[model samples]
Target: MNPDFPILTLLLFLPLVGGVSVVLLWRSPATARVFALLTALAELALGAWLGSAAPAAGPTGYFLYQDLPWIERFGIRYTLGMDGISLVLVLLTAFITVIAMLLSWQEIKERVPLYFALLLATETGILGVFLSLDLFLFYLFWEAMLIPMFFLIGIWGNGRKLYSAVKFFLYTFIGSLLMLVAIIALYLMHGAQTGSYSFALAELVHTQIPYTTGLWLFAAFLLALGVKFPLVPLHSWLPDAYCDAPSAGTVVLAGILAKTAAYALIRFTYPLLPDAARAFTPVIYVCAVVGIVYGAWIAFAQKDMKRLVAYSSVSHMGFIALGIAAWSPVALSGAVLQMVNHGITTGALFVLVGMLSERTGDRESLNYGGLWGKVPVLAFFFLFFNMASAGLPGLNNFVGEFLVLVGTFRVAPGAALGAFLGIVLTLVYTVRLVQDILFGTPSQPMSVSDLSLRESATLASLAVIGVYLGVHPAPVLDLIKVPIALLTKA
Candidate 1:
């Protein structure tokens, strides 16, 4: 709760500042990466303390909030806070950035300095988004990350890297613009009603805008946020970008970036526009259910491993959305916690896929097999993630998915019916991925080795979480329950 020195500000901005300095002070790519990694490590230490010390359970309201008046005349304040949803995300971002640095060790050979710098900068931006309580600060961080991410994909990525980057930037930029307008619209309306201007989410939520106005504001917010969910037709950018980016970039996208939209929906959007959220719950749920089925069906047909993983995210995010839309305590808590699970499980899965691709010099699933016997450790890691993804009974996914299903069934049986189908599809695709990658006949011997010690440490940590949380999810569930309970009141 200490904010005297603005520790969160330092944690969020230092990497970005150091990354920029590396470019100016040390031109060498290796020097850049070393600096970025060093900065990331420092950030991780700070983040670790914050995360571990965060309560095993939280109040139904904000656990930590810091505010300083920025524009007294207009009622704006420089504010930051962490609730149950945010604590996990900020920790995930810092943790994943370190893992991204490790994964980039060999894959990112050229332009290493700029690459890690942008990656670090992107991490800072994401942290800002999660921690910012002021509407203006939130949007600034939201937009700032785009610049680094655009360069990360466009400059250091694959065949359609530029295309993917631009599409990503454009979609999010436009979507976020709409959200910005909504923020302003909400600001002005509330100012008129309350006789003062304010952009604090807490203050704005209490303004009591008419239902009709709330609907439009919600639409604006969702269109901006929803594009990131890349819901169905809007999801065209995710696969290409995922396929084109290097593994490090893709890892951040899957592990952190995409989840931001869903987090916003749960924390900011729903609370601020509850009536609109309630009215649109069924419609949004329909879209989420479609994503569950459609993303899986499309994923089943992908010949490329990266593309398959990308599509699976589309499917997984649908479940995240379903939990949010259901608005039940168990379901929402499950959804919030599942966001962390997805970060660990999916990030590990993609990292493994990238590792195998590096060994084979190809990403096509048909390239080789018989790896299970040859690379048992690698195969073991791969299988663990696959099981987690499948929502296997003893892994993290099962806890979240089960609660979501149980919660949704109580609220809407038809929507739950569609979601149940998604569970089946999840098993289908995950089992196929495991069988094809791990059990296939050996195509050729790999001169490259299995997981490095550092890599193993990273993967093992993620693997342990998947198992530990699965067996005993009470700790995380406790943190998420109060907030979910508070938000779900009729």
Candidate 2:
């Protein structure tokens, strides 16, 4: 809320205003596309600057930290800032927003302006969540962002758009409603104890609640976040939703929504309610390991290409959960890094599926064979992403999963061991997928199209990112250590 540059307000409002502009440009595709890309790119540049400029050690967590009174009586204020962990996620929100827009450039054929407008709105909401130091503001951003996604899936999504959109809405809303109740309870509890009310995260961290109350609060928050992780049984909606949604929409869902949830659990859930998290670790890890194994089992059974990838994400996110449950510092670091790994790798999978569908008119394994021979370039790109998903050596995912497993073995060996078995199952399904889709003989003699220039460029960018992170992750690790060390005190 600092007036100097109004950095936080600028970040939040830019997307809101850009979204409005895109809606106004609804009739012109060319104008809409250009405007949308410009908005996304600008946001990305700003986020990058913010990431680098923020101090390693500062009061509210970053150099840009500041506050302004909103409702003085309630101890509310427009408090916004980032630590290492939050900074990375903010940058991710910006990065994915830009990449998602580019991916949609050629894919979306209608409602261009509305689509991009919603996209920017969604980014704003996500960035708000990452930047806000006030708990109420965080909650507000958390709830507000889902509006655009409901439209993105309903209007631009495929198959049962209404069914999927409504399902996503109801599930998220119920959990968020519970979260709202918890927030109110927190305010009351803080007010009662301190003779003052505050929703600032910094202040709330000091408010001690009984074990029972803390457990209840954690449950409320987890319900909202866990469903988004789409873990195991709660994950039934994902395959259908991702499989049927538009390519860009699927990418955003897989890349951002799930990551947002993972980030939330790490940033807000465990830190705010450490005792509850510890008490609940046994149950949480069981569910996480179950998700890992069960998702792999389902993926192995799926004949739909996109469905396979979707389920794989559930499996990968389960690894994140396990690392979190372990609560070892190293494991937590790996968990943070793995969140990004899942986002990039799975996002790439959806893109490949989209490209394949566009080319050969087949999105299911039952409908494809000898695709590598038909579209070598497409096959090459698809193979790389698949490997990244599988955690092949020298890839982005390998590092995170390895660290998670190693770190967790020291704290929660039982859960980590079970999760390791799940990892083996992961390879089984991923390898089979590659063998079936890329190496098998073609059923039809029809020609398959190669990747377009833009598509290739997009993928190339992703490849470079994977390699860069794989070879040298120290910078990310350095930044992540600060927040994790701080959160440990909670």
Candidate 3:
């Protein structure tokens, strides 16, 4: 909380250090688990503290700014900063990391230490992505996070684990390479125009780019981030990766990893190439609306719970994309809020799905029936999160989606109408899933034992957050108001 303290650096390194420690204590899985949880808890505490401290935004609209020279010749620096947008995501990343560790505690048995280590390492990479102010540093973190995630899916995953891991890697890596090219192009162009080469975001945002060249650069950036956002046609890898990875891995993927792409779109692409961004709005709106409807429609036909949830993410993310594409202050605020809401609600759904799988060794909706009679507690949590995901009136997701629709309607009624259909489809699938899993007669004998204390506590914490955010989104809206205004005005 100290004004002069390097809190961001500590936050950035804490997980890396913990990961290393976890690796060192590989011989003792128990010790490693305990250590890893403590590290995640510590990081979450730091994030909360930073949020409460509420540092003032600097001239560049960043707070807790830290800049140190790194590869000065290229004008790359170990630069990190936070803003209202970054703060919420930092908190989401920290909170989700802890949730992931908890979810994996029992699920990941073999190579336990390595699993926790990878989770923490991914956390550091994601935090770096959120915090880095230099494009080069951001890309470094961007690529670094993929390795552990690849391993997470490849090693501890189920069904088509290797295939899914490879697909996830290739999709993200190829996109990243394109983005790398774009970053270098932007750097060179800025240097050519201003006689100074820099990958500093603050510097590049002021670059004078030709419209044609900007379009290409923006497309490159969009291709890279869209893959991660898994925007419609670019989302092929999501269902596989989400369905195959272990529950903890799936939670991280659905919860926070995808948000990084949305974050990048807002942070880098839109700001660095404003003209290209505006020019691409129509295209983005089309993709967003298509993804919303297509993802929801596909989800309705899914029999597997994991796959359903995975597809639902594609739908929810589409809604977020639509908001961003709308590019209004209200829509952007909603998008930011929905980012957190999706992280909580969808993350909880995935967690509950994992729990159900653990109990029944199955994830099929049809295979599960009358769970309410068998495991009332688990059924309650599952239903609660499903409604949250469905954007029920008083739950967390409704507020975000409502704002997105309202804002998009003002700008593009057609897109808003399309997204509204996705919402209706969302409710349809949600109700079907609820009825199939919770209300029907048992199709087969399954484990009737309910949630453990730890599982209950985990779901309880997320549920409480969803309720609070749903009822009191004013605080989060206030937090993001200035940043969204800056972004929309820009």
Candidate 4:
């Protein structure tokens, strides 16, 4: 632990503190936006510092670890730490939050103060989730993420806002409850075996239990995570919520919240319940392949841009899940990398889509045509990220998706083949989407401006990240390799 500065604590609470201050100060709307942006930038700077401070190339465990007693009676503590994998994720969270805040600058009008406040609070919750080392603390942060997001959607969303918000809440809430039950069960089991009560994740990881008991507990955790990962059949709530939420909310939802499920599988589920994870691998692999094909096929049928991208996410996230099911070191490492890749590509897509909708007041593919001529810069960005999302070479998504496919194929050739088919389907739908919006004949006389300086700045930053990940992802791969190696070896 670095005693010189409590960097983790600062990262965890700064946004929260800034959020409260924003609300209390609550001056002009412009003031709110500037303050939120500054706070978000500060978090980003701190995240960069943490990344720089991390071990460059080693199987180092958690750094800047702070384990302090919180609930002495129950053996819970305010435990926080970050390893290679977590450091990258923390950086992604900070980057996306800053971009999301800036993207919302003009789009969010009503209750601006409250909107930025919620955004900051949500950032805090997500940061906490990525950093917490205690199961109890993790669960607290897990639910903490939901409250502000629920309000963000309910208050600032478009049509069907209230319905979508409630549905999102209900789905995630039910999942969280199941996870809580599993957590309690684990706590009890650990206490019985070790003659001590503790909610620390590291303590729980060493727990010994019967295969039968572990299987049921793993199922409970998987069910909760499945809903969030939103594998086929369980993904019904996502379209409505993603399509209806404000664009800023959609960026966070797709970019960060959805990825949390994949992260949890790596961080907690696999390590703690290795046997059950292996036992369940086949079924999970099937779901992943199915989701990939299903989401791509459904995305081809969508007319609304937001809904289309939402379904595309279902397909893309399947790749992450597939890598996890493979359980190979290569696959797990690829999955971690894909988590960050998806955040950058998908976050960029949402921002671009939001910019278009903000100007034209419509997001239907049918309503747009020859956008390339009207807003060439927007068209260029749209195509760039579209291709990136399609896993084009020399782009971020390609690197992660390729690694995932290669790693999975080594273990599950049949499942990998199915995923490959989904990839082809994805390319088709992506091109169709781009052609419909950017190259087709106009439905009516069109008038829209190119990307503004602020919007261009956001897209450019994401583009740089995409290219960096595609061409030179070693930095990220290095950071995550040891942690992933540990999980795979376990």
Tens-place lDDT per residue, model 3, 203-314, is: 9999989999999999999999999998989999999999999999999999999999999999999999999999999999999999999999999999999999999999
lDDT per model vs. reference: 0.84, 0.82, 0.93, 0.90
Measure candidate 4: CA RMSD. Answer: 1.2
TM-score to true structure, per model:
0.95, 0.96, 0.99, 0.98
**Worst 10 contiguous positions by lDDT, candidate 1:** 53-62
Candidate 3 residue-pair clash tally = 0
For candidate 3, list the clashing residue pairs, or say none: none
Better by TM-score, candidate 3 or 1: 3
Candidate 1, superposed: residue stretches over 4 Å from native = 1-3, 54-60, 72-74, 442-448
RMSD of each: 2.0, 1.8, 1.0, 1.2
Residue 298 CA displacement from its true place in model 4, Å = 0.2
Model 2, C-alpha of 62: deviation from truth (Å): 2.5
Ranking by lDDT: 3, 4, 1, 2
lDDT of 4 by residue, 136-243 (tens): 999999999999999999999999999999999999889889999989999999999999999888899989979998999899889888988888878999999999
For candidate 2, the lDDT comes to 0.82
Candidate 1 displacement at residue 126 in angstroms: 0.8
lDDT of 2 at 265: 79
